[model samples]
Target: MSLFVTYVLVLGRSLESSRGLLELLTPALELEVDDSPLSLSLHAAAIQLWCLVNSRSFSSSDKILTEAYSRLRTAIQDPLQRGCESTVLAALLLQRYERFSAVWNQHEQCHVHRNGALALLRQQKLDGINSKHRGYLISQLFHSEVNICISKKISFQASEITWLRDQDLSILPSNPSTALDIIGASIASHQHKFTLLSAEEFITASKPDLSQWYQDLQDTEDQLNNWPSTVPRHWLPQTLQSGKHFDQSIITYAGYSDIYPNIQIASIWNLWRTYCLLLLQIKLALLGLFPNLDEPTGTTQDPRIPAFKVKSVQLAQVLVDSICQSVSFHLGNYIEPTSLSELMIPTILCTSYHDMDPSHISYTLYQKSSLFMSRDDHRRHVIVQGPWHMMGTLSHVLSILADSESHIPVHALREGQMNWVRTQFLRVLRLLRIDLEDLSATNQDHCQANPGDLHALNTVNSEIIAKRLMAALAG
Candidate 1:
């Protein structure tokens, strides 16, 4: 959309000079400055390593990382001290560090760090660490995990689902993340455990408890319908219909999108719709929307298939609009005057581009169909921004000239609207060229090494990337 591309340019132009980003800290790391936080030397070092990664001091990136890993090895050796709140926070920051090293951290480094944080949190719960900080930590971790799974289309294993269901449900309903958190357990099960892997497997699996399975399905639908009402007025989004003057090339695949008070809130709204879209497909499959898996190739068609597509587009149109609108806030041309807000730009914008992951669906439901030349071809013909389009030439070559197609970025430029800002944006993208190329190369290795499964597949949307995306936006 012209909306997001413009804001991205505005922010990209300012990234290099935002040396003070670590001082502000992200929302999750806004720890009380008292002695209760990061007392241990390992925790202190982890925070320092996090700072090094974000300060754009790539010269020290490798050396300090080596030291961080050595200290982490030392800390992990003592199982008795592992469950402390300080330890969890340290692991979380190290997770941030792994995310920043786009060149080499690959899927393995960050995923390993994430598992470390999760394990530490699990241990804390077992040790009766019921403090407020622990609760905050767990919720943030769950948010990350859900995003990871949705972004990659990973099916949660049975053990992970069990862990999700057992989490604290006492979080206040008024909290923004709580709405998603409350039903996340159901989502985990719906996403993987009870999903339709195949018609025969599903039928066989549910036969033993058909009634309970349908009951769970009904309860999930109820939760989704009821979840929005529980939100406080300020947290709720304003619904707006598209107008005659609206740019069809941009947004409103449906007739409307949402207006949120901030990018964070908008991100949450988009995350919800993404989940809705994911579940819609599964629900449709379960209800026989796709062809039956057991029948001979091309031999069986569910009568509901045609109706399912019409309905899917109808429902998905608005969800698509909402997701784009959410990304729009992150690309703010006039949302706020402060650079601090820029530090929060996240993967809601970065991961919005796609092929809809073949592991999930045959058709690209989540991505706008406009990205392709025609419904029949599915070949990308338009020029869209790729992941971290803030990174240079390679992204443009890959996302625009090659696959991941759409003409949104081209349109953003053709209007000559933000011409002045475009130069600065490209400058920053070019600056990070190596990092982005390395990330792409490493991800390719991950795909080849673990054929058909990608572990560290999501964007590393580190503080540095957020800072770069926001830093150059002039008031």
Candidate 2:
């Protein structure tokens, strides 16, 4: 077997054994007598895709994906077969494959798989099944659905999954398992509220009742405030001390290698904060509040708006800075692909916020370096290779860079890195089949736009593209 396949089998086997579901989901040994053919097929296809991605064998990956999807379609056509645990497991594996291998425009298929998983859960009453493996699968599917909803600017199907709930901080002291359950559920709840607020109807409809919205925001903020006290100390944000050789180089400054035992959980905490900041931005936008360094002289200004903007910016900066500090630890240690993928969503959220400033000088330098350095040279020097999905995040980063038309000096970037970042952005857009002509017009409009106008424009553009891609996939 390929090394990538070997790693997947080993990791899957470990998880299966730990969950005490080895008999149900055997990942290590060859196809067992009791294993469903559909499950075995999915297991094989997932292994093949992993190897193909690592090896950059796109042709083979496409072939394997096609065959696996065919089998999946046939299996899911039968209601009885679709409702089985094996089919759910197969669906999860297929979703993983799509996430890693799907081309940019085809990403909506990930959501299709998520919806399928949810349907199976409902049909089989899997939520009532008290298996650890079932809980794991549910959590994974829940997170995936939330991510799709956020990324695509789609409305959360709240009515479809009423079982999700907010995290209960009171229970964390006595039960870690319940705490995890709450955390997963809470993420779904927050994402749902976020989607509701962001929907087109909410934005364009006649002015909403600000009172209820404000109360919801307060409730979320309170929950966030209460969250840190419940978690273990290591999962709380840590202050990174400057190393003795701090001034050695840009790379050295960016590389703050203080690894924590619970860095993964710490990353999740930071992600939650980032989500809060995003919601704050949406709330502020609804109230026509925006950061304006220039003093507003007109009577239209709300005196408190400036303070709110400052506070919002500060909170966003803190959350982003915490995430960047932890990046060094992730770089120093080995993180599985799944964990790394989880980390990318927060990074994307942080980068997408147009006004938040980078907290560390090194972070700014690293971004500058990414723009200036040759791709080959940067790859040779960088310690961690972020997953493929990170390309989408980088595309958003590139948009931010490009959108800083008059505010930032273009000439300041090193010629090579500027060319490189632009090239990569174009490459991503091309893969997504986004029109270059439209993007140029959008960029021109943004250049002439005010901060608030630009923010709205970006939001609309994102939603338009997301809707288009999703519709295309559905058709």
Candidate 3:
């Protein structure tokens, strides 16, 4: 916790006085001459934005803003194509939103971050953009708007809520519980999705979020696909019979053959655990209220599964720390001068934050449609079934990492290793922190001692998650 606070202040102070930052404010803002890598460039830009946002003087900050805006305009107008133009634009926009405190005032010029974000959203809508990039843009737009509304303690517009709900329908995971109900002809006409309505809507919605009792289906698929031939037919029985060591056999049953599977699994789980912890830590740092967590506990008869679930939150935090250590360890081994290693924190944060979209859980969107309903029923759909959908996905990822034999060394990746890095683990590190561990652990423990029906409600990690998120914005 102290480490995070110290780092924040150190980085903040340095950002306010960086020579390169000052140079960026100069008439000529030069791109590094060497091909330093797009990730490096993006990270540099994020850091510059952070400094500007925390700057006391708007004049010093304006230079960064103008330069960044200029660079973005150039990219948009460039005749020669670039590799990640949309990413650059999105980064700039996120930086813009971060600069505006989570409040809106009519007295100030509406041309700054908040309204500018609204304009960007409108522009995307007008352009009919539907790519993944556009999806992220819309998500950020709604997210920023929501932040403003929450800060102001006001009711956001119904139309904007509808836009988010509808967009979520296409991008979020779906389930039977999120299906529509007959509120009234007029009321239903105005609002079809219950999730779009206020907190009261969730209370009244019928068949609430009864998606499933399992972990990530995608992970299940991946585990099956990557199954090692050496795994015995039964993991528990065979391992117990060996009496030599169940831990080694558990790894084998899951198809893991690494020399240090325990350490490896610990590292992986610790990374995620630390990520959640960091989120919580940041929340406390910012003195923000935690989010609500009233969802029902997932019912699974298997005792082992329940035990594992109980440790989910703690496990997630541990995983986050392990990830940081792993990445840092690898970076230290491969990179020279050591100074570049610190850059990984910001780079990983920005990149991973972009990866965990509610839309990614497109696999189980409509698993619980009525027998009478058609397979192609669109009305039954909902965007992310709930926040737990993501939790389940993350849990499954941890399970997969626990089972796999893939090694992520400093210099190179083993076969099947890059896939995990590409799909989930890397991104989780960016947007999460250590504090989420306690929140998750609490839920998991509660479920363990008293198991029953639990709706897929989000936990107290929201405020914490938001804070860790600010760290990314700092980048």
In model 1, where is the ten-residue run with the lowest total lDDT? 375-384
Pull out the clashing pairs in model 1.
13-472, 14-471, 14-472, 107-456, 254-317, 382-406, 383-406
Give all candidates' CA lDDT scores.
Answer: 0.40, 0.42, 0.28
lDDT of 2 by residue, 1-475 (tens): 3333332333212221121122234542234232443444455555554444343344554655566567667777876666556666666666555554454334455456657777777666664433345655555555554545454445455535545434222312232323333443444454455446546665554323444555555666666566667754433343344333222121111344332322223334544554554455454554442223123334255566566656655565554344445443333221222222322233221111011134644334434431223322222112222222223333333332343221222343333333433433333333223443435566635533532221233332432343333332320
Residue 404 displacement in candidate 3 (angstroms): 35
Alpha-carbon RMSD to native, per candidate: 15.1, 12.0, 19.6
TM-score of each: 0.52, 0.56, 0.28
Any runs in candidate 1 off by more than 4 Å, and if so which?
1-59, 71-83, 102-110, 126-131, 148-157, 160-168, 171-174, 193-196, 203-215, 239-258, 289-309, 333-475
Using lDDT as the measure, name the better of candidate 2 and candidate 3: 2
What number of backbone clashes does candidate 3 have, counting pairs of residues 3 or more apart or in separate chains?
Answer: 45
lDDT of candidate 1 over 188-217, digit per residue (tens)? 666664334545765566432544554576
**Sort by lDDT, best first: what order?**
2, 1, 3
Candidate 2, residue 475: Cα displacement in angstroms equals 18
